[model samples]
Structures are given as C-alpha cells and as structure tokens.
Target: MKPTLLAVAHGTRSAAGQRQIRDLVAAVARRRPELDVRLSYVDVQQPRIGDVVPAVRDAVVVPLLLSAGYHVRVDIANAVEGTGIPVTGTLGPDEVLLRSLTRNLPAADAVVLAAAGSSDPAWRESTHEMASKLQAHVAYASGSAPKVADVVADLRRRGARRIAIAAYLLADGLFYRTLHRAGADSVTPPLCLDPTVAGLVLRRYESALLTTAAGRL
Candidate 1:
C-alpha cells in the first residue's frame, strides 16, 4: 500500500480558517490522486495528531506550519515516535511558499512579512531569512519584539509611500484577520489553498519517503 500523507495543521476557531484548511487538503488530493491524503490538527480542533497517527499503519506526517517549533518538534515528533512513520519538515523557507506569498501580494512601496511569532531564536532567524529573500520586512503577530504594527509604522516613517503586509500564515484565522489592523496600506491573505503549496506538500512527502527507503536499504 502507498504511504498515507497526513497533512497536520494548527487548528483555529475561525470559520474561514477551517475552510482554508479543508480547501488546501482538497487541493492536495487533486494533485496526487494516487496517494491517500488525510487531515489532522495539532491543537484547537478534533481528531488530534496523536489519535490520527496511530490509526495509519504506514504514513508520512507533513506539518502545515511555516516553521519547525513546538508543534512540529515536540507534538508531531512524539506522535509518530516508535511507529516508524516519517514526518516531513514544516512548509516554509522554501521558494514554493514564497511564490504563493508573492503571487497574492498587493502593490505597495514596501511589504512586510508578518508571522505568528515564536520565542525560539531559530524560528525568528528563519523568518528573517525569508523576509530578506522576499525583500520585505519581518515582524511578529505576537511573542516577540518589533510587532506587526511597529514594523508597519516604521516602514511608513522611513518614507515608504505605501506599505503592504504579506501574511506568512497557513490559513485564515485570528492572526490572518488581525494583519489588516496592523496599520499597513493593505494586508494580503494567508498562504492557503494554492497550487504551489499543494505541489510543495507532495514534494515533501515524496522526499521523505525516498529518505526512509534509503535508510532501510
């Protein structure tokens, strides 16, 4: 049997957020009809990762997260432990994701990438790297310094005629909506349900399977 791909997301209460995740999963299904694609959540939703992982005898878990942090490192890593199931890295710091973000971006004199911040320096560093690649500023929605509003304001103060926010988020949720109020000229939508993202999902799944096969050989 082909290995199942478990697309795990950090769930949210917003209805839009739920819809985005469902649509994203559907896109993945469309891309790889040969594989069984399933959805599960790490938090704030039903059918948690722990419950979902055990049901599948052979699987690869791909986190629908921008960066590897608590959920990806601790929660997901533990969920598949002792099961011999492979888990792919989080879906950011990649050109595929950057393509989606840039495609959806609105016109502006300057753009800022806003993320759900983390205390981990590595996560922040990765986000910064992506920002540098995109030629955009980096700020956090929460959890760290130089918050979204501050970043937006500073860009404007520095004489940026128009400021835009590219939400570096997976789905529509509280953080997605909150980007608009960050005082930017415009805030793009979350990086969700795009063909590029679906492609990235398949790429991660295929690469992990290849690595696992090599290890066993």
Candidate 2:
C-alpha cells in the first residue's frame, strides 16, 4: 500500500488563502486518487504537524513551502522524529516552479522575484538561485532586508520603466497584499493556483516513496 501523503503548509488566517491551500491539495488528490491525502499546518492554523503525524501509521510528509527554513529543519523534523516517517524536501528550486514562474512572468523591462525572507542563509540562497534562473532581481516580501518596494524603486531609478513582480508566494494573503502595493507595474498571482505546482507536489511525494522503499531494501 502507498503511504499516506500529508501535505503540510504554513497556514494563514485569510479565507482566500485557506481556500487556495485546500484547492492545491484537492489538485494533488486528483493526480493520485488512490492515495490517501491529508492536510495540516506547521503554524497559524489547526491540525498542526505535531498533532497529525502521530496519528498516521506510515506516511510521507511533503512540505508545501517553497523554501527551506526553521519550519522545515526544526519544526517538521521534530514532528516526525520518533514516528519513523520520511519527510520530503520543500517544494522549490525545482524545474516545475521555474516553469510556473516563466509562464506567469509578465512583459516588462525588469522583474523582481519577491519571496518571504528567511533568517536561514540556505533559505535566502534558494530564492537567490531562483532569481538567477529567471535573470531577475531578488527582494523580500517581509522578514528581511531589500524590501520589494525598494527593489521596485531601484529598478525605476535604473531606467526600468516597466517593472514586474513575480510573487514567489505559495498562496494569497498578507504578503500578496503587500507585494501588490510595492509599486510594480504588474504582479503575477501566487504559485498556489498554478497547474504545475500540483504536479510538483506529486513528484516530491513519489521521490519520498522511492527513498522509503530503498531504505527498506
């Protein structure tokens, strides 16, 4: 039997943001109808990872986050520690995300990839790498320096009249509202609604499955 797939995320209070997360998980279910799928959050919501992981006998935890951070390294690790479950890597820095970004990128003289900043250098580095892949500037939505508004202003001063924002967010909420007000001419929607994102989740789950199988063998 395939292990249960627990789709974990950093929950939000915004109703729309909640719906986006649920819809994304629904999409994942559509991809593999036979798989038992579940949802939980690491923070700001109910059914927290600690509460959910212990209830499952065998499962693969796939983080819905796009980058690595304290949530991935500490919170999640602790949740599955004594449970002997395999936690898949966060869903990011992958070609699937790159495709979603490229397709959503608007026509502009310059583009800034706006991510939720992290204190972890590795987390920040992942966003920088994505920026490099898109040949775009990097800025933070919050929690770090070089805010999106500042990046947009710098682009304008540098003769970039048409600046776009590629919102590197998984769902809409406080961050998307802030990003839209960052003075960019255009801001693409969050990655949660992208069709490719669902596929990426499945790929991550499958990879974890393979790893689990290999360990058993």
Candidate 3:
C-alpha cells in the first residue's frame, strides 16, 4: 500500500500564500516520490483540510502550522479526528528550526522570537522556554504583553547594539510583513520554500506512515 503524505497548510488569501503551499508540495514531492503527496489549506484557500484528508486514501496529517495552538489542538484536530490519520506536531519552533533562526543573527545584542500567536495558552506557553533559552530578547507577533514592537523597544531600552527578528511563520506573507514593521534593526528571512523545511516534512511523513498505526491499514 502506498501511504499517502498530506502536506497540509494553513491557507491564506494572498496569491503568495497559495503559491507557498504549492511550492511546499513540490519540495515534498522531490524527496518522497513514491508516496502520494497532497496539499490543502485550513482556511481562505481551496481544498480545505477536510477536503484534503479524504483524497489521501490513508495518511498521516502533517500540520504545516507553526504552533500547537487552537488550530492544531482544536480546529485541525476536530477536522481529522475520525479520519484515523495520526497527526504530527507543528513544524516550527522545533529544535531544528532554531538552527535556521539563529543563523539569521550574525551578531545580536537581542532577538525577538516572533510568531503568529493564538489564544491557546498551550501554544503561547510552548514558545516561552525556547525564547528565554536563546538568551536574546523574545516576543510574539500575535499575542502577549511584549509584542514584536514592544520587544524591540525593550531591547533598545537596554541599549542593544543590534536587533535581529526571527519569524515563526511557515511562509512569506502578512505575519512576516508585520514582524518587519515592528521596529527592529534587522529581521531573519521569512521561512520560505526551502529544501530543509521540506526535508523535515518528509521525515514526519515517514514516521507517520511507517508506524504500526499507519501500517495497520
């Protein structure tokens, strides 16, 4: 049986948003040619997650979503629950991602770990440790007291020589745009259709489908 690999994305209205998901699909296809590769959005896009999952005969759902927020914990979960596909964790904020984020900072007096926040405390809380551990400044794009702007302000207050903002976004779009305007000396590139990220998706795909649950089919 060819285990399907669903590369699910949180969709957007921007042309770039759809394009990003397609680019991601192409990248995932390169690594795992044998598996069925499918793309779908969670909102404001075609082929919603509900529609995307059924197309895959049997598969593991990989939420391209950044954090385990209401979307992953509730929205996405409710969507795929009975489908019998084990969902993997969100792709960003992982240890591997920090490598790319830190690479953006050639030298940083402080850093803002910016993300598209969610009201879900679990999601928000998940990022705190990583942000604090970095030893640079930290903040979010969506929620909490020290937003990106405030974070940069706090850093400047401390007289940071250079401030580098790293986006926790899955693709290039509004969140990245907002993070830039939030007052920073510089920002890491928006996570785009990169090979490494695609590779990570493929890794999740392998583990999801090869495990006994996926094998039970």
Question: After superposition on all CA atoms, how large is the RMSD of candidate 3?
Answer: 2.2
CA lDDT scores, all candidates in order? 0.87, 0.92, 0.74
Candidate 1 stretches with Cα past 4 Å from truth are none
Lowest lDDT block of 10, candidate 3: 129-138
lDDT, candidate 1, 1-217, per-residue tens: 7558999999999998999888988999988887789999999998899998878867889899989888887899889889988899788889987888888888889999999999887788889888998899889898787799998888888999889888898888887777888888887777876767888888888889899999999
Top-scoring candidate (TM-score):
2
Two-way lDDT contest, 1 vs 2, winner: 2
Error of 3 at 214 (Å): 9.2
Q: lDDT of candidate 3 vs native?
A: 0.74
TM-score of each: 0.95, 0.97, 0.90
Give candidate 2's total backbone clashes: 0
RMSD of each predicted structure? 1.3, 1.1, 2.2
RMSD of 1: 1.3
